[model samples]
Target: MARNQQNELQALQDTLYFIGGKWRIPIINSICNGNKRFREIERSIPGITTRMLSKELKEMEMSKLVKRTVYADTPVLIEYEPTEHCRSFGKIIQEMIKWGESHRAIVLKKRT
Candidate 1:
């Protein structure tokens, strides 16, 4: 591969290393779409266990894509929200949604 191609591939790999998973995108979308609490996120993404959610959230926080806030209330309410850095992914996510819809339609038509 050419030098430019190698550099581009590395960048893509780095991006994937951060958010490449079945759970991470949904987790991000849930929080971005206003599902702030832990239970809300878990409910939003069906089939995700509490353990998995906790683990992924910790990873995202370390990557600076998500922020966890704890409020000193009667019971210490915790909320999750996407960081400003994560806002950069909004367009990328939308493009992925568009591509997925088209790909799904194409594959389903082949099946039927």
Candidate 2:
């Protein structure tokens, strides 16, 4: 393969390694949709447990998709907010959501 093609393939692989997970997209979306607190995220995603959410948040923070802020207080509160890098994904996710909804409508209507 050409150098340009090889670089492009590697970049795609990195992107997949970064965002290819069951929880990453939902975690990003929840943060984008205004759930910053840990509990808030847990509540926003119906089936995610505290442990899994915590792990996902930590991973996102490491990947720079989310920022973690801790307030200096007697029981310090931690909030997870999406970084600019993550905000860039908003348009993509919006398009995906539109596609998903359209597909769901067609499939469900066919089923019923």
Candidate 3:
């Protein structure tokens, strides 16, 4: 492949890897929508088990997509927030939502 094609391929691969999982994007959306606590995030995404949410959050933290914070008080509190890197992907997610809505309409129209 040409150098330009190789670069584009790598970029596409990276993006796919980032959003490859069933839970990653929804988890990111939950956090960006202000579901910071573990339980809150879990509840916000239906069909996500506690174990899956924990696993995804840990992976996202390792990938620098989220910042995990711990607070000490009467009870220890932990929260997850999207990092700037993750926030940058928000625009792409929004565009995807738009495209998905349009595609669904088209499919329904064709079916009718």
Candidate 4:
């Protein structure tokens, strides 16, 4: 492949790897939509098990996609918020949502 094509391919691969898992994007969307607490995030995404959410959050923190903050209160509270790096991907996610809606409409129209 040409040098430019190789670079583009690598970038696409990185993006795919980042958003590879079934839970990652939904987790990000939940957090970005103001679901900070663990339970809140869990409830926002139906069909995600407790174990999966815990595992995904840890991985996301390691990837610098989310910040886990623990508040020392009478009852300790933990919250997860999207990091600046993750926030940068918000526009792309929005576009994907738009595209998905449009694609579904087209497919349904064809079936009709």
**How badly does each model clash, as a count of residue pairs?**
0, 0, 0, 0
Worst 10 residues of 3 by lDDT: 87-96
**Which candidate number has the best lDDT?**
4
Please tell me which predicted candidate would have the highest TM-score against the true structure: 4
- Please, what is the whole-model Cα lDDT of each candidate in the order they appear? 0.87, 0.86, 0.90, 0.91
Q: What is the C-alpha RMSD of each candidate to the true structure, in Å?
A: 1.7, 2.3, 1.4, 1.2
Tens-digit per-residue lDDT, 4-99, candidate 1: 999999999998887778898888777777888999999999999999999999998998988889999999999888898776785578778899
Give Cα distance to truth, residue 65, candidate 4, Å.
1.0
| Residue 95, candidate 4: alpha-carbon lDDT | 84
With candidate 1 superimposed using the best TM-score fit, by how many Å does residue 9's alpha carbon deviate from the native? 0.3
Model 2: per-residue Cα lDDT over 15-103, one tens digit each: 77877878778887889988989988899888888899889888878888889999998899888888888988855777889999999
Assess candidate 2 and give its TM-score to the true structure.
0.83
TM-score comparison, 3 vs 4, better candidate: 4
In Å, residue 22's CA in model 3 sits off its true spot by 0.7
- TM-score per candidate, chains pooled: 0.88, 0.83, 0.92, 0.94
Give the C-alpha miss distance for residue 92 in model 2, angstroms: 1.4
Model 3 residue 103 CA deviation in Å: 0.9
Q: Report the lDDT of model 1 for residue 65.
A: 87
For 1-112, candidate 3 gives per-residue lDDT tens digits of 6999999999999899989979888888888888899999999999999999989999999999999999986689998999988887866787888999999999999999
Root-mean-square deviation of Cα positions for candidate 2 versus the true structure, in angstroms: 2.3
